[model samples]
Target: MTTILIKQVSWQQHQPELQALRQQVFVVEQKVPAELEWQADDEDAYHWLAYGPQQQVLGCARLLKTGTLGRMAIAKTARGQNIGLRLLQAAMDFAQQQLGLAEVHLSAQTHALGFYQKAGFVSEGAEYHEAGIPHIHMRKKLSPQPQLGISNGKFFVSQHKNTVLTMAQQCRRQLRILDYNLNPAVFDNQALVDAVSALARRHRNSSIKLLLIDSQAVIKRGHGLLKLQRKLSSSIAIKQLSDDTGVSDNLVLADDCGVIVQSLVNPETIWADFNNKPVAQSKIDHFEILWGQANANNDFRLLDL
Candidate 1:
């Protein structure tokens, strides 16, 4: 089996490799005009490359600051291996976690519409010609808004653990989490860990404050977020509730824009709001008061293996 690795690269650092892959896939194989393939916007866009076992470039893609995903190409030999999917996912991750964008847009070739659709992209407009190739406007909404509410507000009820984690990734400036025992099942998800790690790495002034009533379960199971808190001590902090104040509601707040609140007694029933400011702010203020009363926890260190 061949191992394939996908990573982000700078235009200046991996110019030759990116150019070679694009030339082979786009210019020669697809017969796209040279002048049209190599656009001036390449310099300003963020680029990514997918490499095979021997470090050979198999695919490439770029993301614009305005959330446009374009110039995606996969080598002929790598077509059936899902390299394009990885490249597209990398672009979407960059747009959300690193750039803090709400959604991603792409001009997908009409024939490849099915491919993008599998990745959650929906066609927005009629097909048109771009550089002699049929193209259509497509977009993928990155943030999940609440499912129910009025014109200015909406509410979401998440029954599964992944839904709550997905909401946490949309957090940009600040994140406040409250739960009982800080259950490893919820905080140990790899995707959620990566999202939080990327957020801390991209935003220097961002804060992630976690408050748990009991951390015995998490400590026994080895939580990834605990390890992350230790590594990013300045940005992430873990605390234990010193009193019984505000322990009934398990919540996650993202800045002043979004919030997820579940009853600690009934974890399955979760209520979240992505657009309502007043509701989110109320939860945030309650969190701050509880946070102030919480005590710093230093027991998250690695245990003997």
Candidate 2:
């Protein structure tokens, strides 16, 4: 892999290299019309350039304050070397930080869908031709809002609340956890190991199962927890949940307090207990209902292993 340095560029300083790359890729190679290519207010637009160790510009992109991101180009020599991703990352970061934009939208060429997808941009609708080339709108959610609460001390979004960045959980006490469709942050193996170890120390000789939900296990990073499960061994049984399924409402019944951790995208409607604690009884019941449906048959496999 080639080493690349990303830096914000003044429109004037980067204009020559940027226009050349754009003319090469979008105009000459992709047949984009010169009329539509470079016109309008580019002076106010923020531009970025990627450079090699020798300060040779390898890629460039511009983020106009229209909530629209466009004109990203990578030199032909830098193609397949991931310079485009670096440019997009820089562009998105600038748009979020300086512009405070909620979403960065782009009309991505159809063939480049995979590239954008890897960079976290989701395709929205049907493809249309622009300058005779097929294109589609793509958007990436830049500021990944946390649900609330940290796992041990490091920042981890609450997949349930969709807003709060909760403090990390390091206590050994049994927790009365709540459920919300949350996108919990990916945890390192050591953290998972610590969680499993803590659970073991708290619930010694008790039947404690590791309920792996669809969003957390398969969707987010399936293989991560699978590795943690192996390191944990027979201490906790791994249960898998289908995408449509949820936890059993009686998830609280098996233990003194339940630990509910899932992505907050599809939150369980309930938020607090009668006493206003974070634990929600009704949602816990729903979790139990879904929990019973999860296939108990053990199947934790890691691709790398």
Candidate 3:
């Protein structure tokens, strides 16, 4: 657990040291062909190097603008303490933050796929050989994020675990309705429906989430939630669950056994059933796959015409 610090390299200052380190690690130790080791594009890339307190290069990685992350190498002295994962994370962050890449791809040595998987990269296509080593192309998608607005003034907000509730008596939360590929009106007339409707009316223009999961085809029907979702109108995002993937939508449903809705003022506070669960990201990933393939080309505003 030795402390390691990473420094962003400035071409004029760190290039020589970086080149020397690469030559030692890639050309000599790893036997990466010389021609492939030094590309003309190195001068334009954002480079980072991890250094011990004495200023020795412990690890390094580079970010290329083409969304290709490559050339990560660590000193032989630092091989087993997980320095590589840190380098990879730094490279991935730079690729997304500085280069604005949507998807980051890496050509990982076959044996190292497990390492990449831990960092959120999935293998693509099939295995191939690069520079006399077995390799696989791996990719990780960066979530599309919006500029987060800062709240200048502190408002009196209450917390329910992570779920935020407004000051309203019966309607202080945003509820995401889960539709199991069915109509949205299945729960409209129940006590759950009346409570949610009253809350929505209280908020007026705030957005409440409704998530639909259609498992009837897979599970052969039993849940009442799935039935309500099928009847809901369009203009809503209803994602289907599959065994192969995880949920893709950050938009999640409520956790109550009955219908769930919360105040829009603290939408981020609502916790889904998967809250604090380790596999929650996998669930969101599953929803994203279905969402990506769903047709959304219609002009939403012109639907009335």
Candidate 4:
């Protein structure tokens, strides 16, 4: 196996190398038309070049400003070395860690659908012809938006509300929230209510469980989440922790991968990381113990489904 190294290159500094690689793969080998192959966007797009021994270009891919990833090509000699996969990872890492793009879109050659799918991209719509080749639209959501909030920072009320809502929008399988009171300003918002509702319809096994220290106040406040739960009783469950439970931190877990942690002692102090499975799992494990001991607030039983 050959060692593969990937690096982002500038069109201005590495034009000869970039063009040579693309021309070799996309034009000569694939017979893509020379006129159609060269685009003005090359100069502005983010270019990633994979190198073999002695810094020879092995593969290349580009990400456009609009979050489109394309122009991916691997040398014939390098096809079996996983050079293409590493190059694609480089592009995606840059998009998520540096560019802060919420998601990426690509027109994948139909035959390569499985290749991209292996990297967590989902294919959408029917196959269409592009440059005389069958292609399909595909996209992968990067780590969810309103990204990680460090514990050192204090959030304004609006920031906290927006972050939870944005995180809720990305939930797929399940959403588990453990909070002090299920604050009306954050959990009762229409945006979160709608997101949870949509998630419930996404799968029959989808689950939403909320643990609150106080349910009487939430019910009296006419919370939208409580209302949603009553209407979707089979999909949503709300429980109240007894006073004996020592938990004081508020947590919002999305799909068991994303998390928003807030200090109940200091509501403004918060931390949100949308891609930390370990932290989410640990917090969820503790939450489950509490969830099991917590009583299903009978108040919800009074509302008609």
Best by TM-score: 1
RMSD of each: 11.5, 14.9, 19.3, 15.7
Top-scoring candidate (lDDT): 4
What would the per-residue lDDT of candidate 3 be over residues 84-143, giving only the tens digit for each residue? Answer: 776776676566555678999889988788988988899989888888989999999975
Query: Candidate 4 lDDT, tens digit per residue, 109-195?
Result: 998999999988999999999778899999999753344322223222214666788778878888998877788867887888999
**Stronger candidate by lDDT (3 vs 4):** 4
Model 3: residues >4 Å from true position, as ranges?
146-305
TM-score versus the correct structure, for each prediction: 0.51, 0.48, 0.48, 0.49
After superposition, which runs of candidate 2 have C-alpha atoms over 4 Å from their true positions?
145-305
- The TM-score measured for candidate 4 stands at 0.49
C-alpha lDDT of all candidate models, in order:
0.78, 0.56, 0.54, 0.79
Give the Cα-based TM-score of candidate 1 against the true structure. Answer: 0.51
Q: How high is the lDDT of residue 284 in model 2?
A: 48
How does model 2 score by TM-score? 0.48
Candidate 3 versus the native: TM-score?
0.48
lDDT of 2 by residue, 126-201 (tens): 9998888899999887764222222212222212221111112332333222222212432334454455456656
Tell me how far the alpha carbon of residue 143 in candidate 2 is from the true structure, in angstroms, after superposition: 2.6
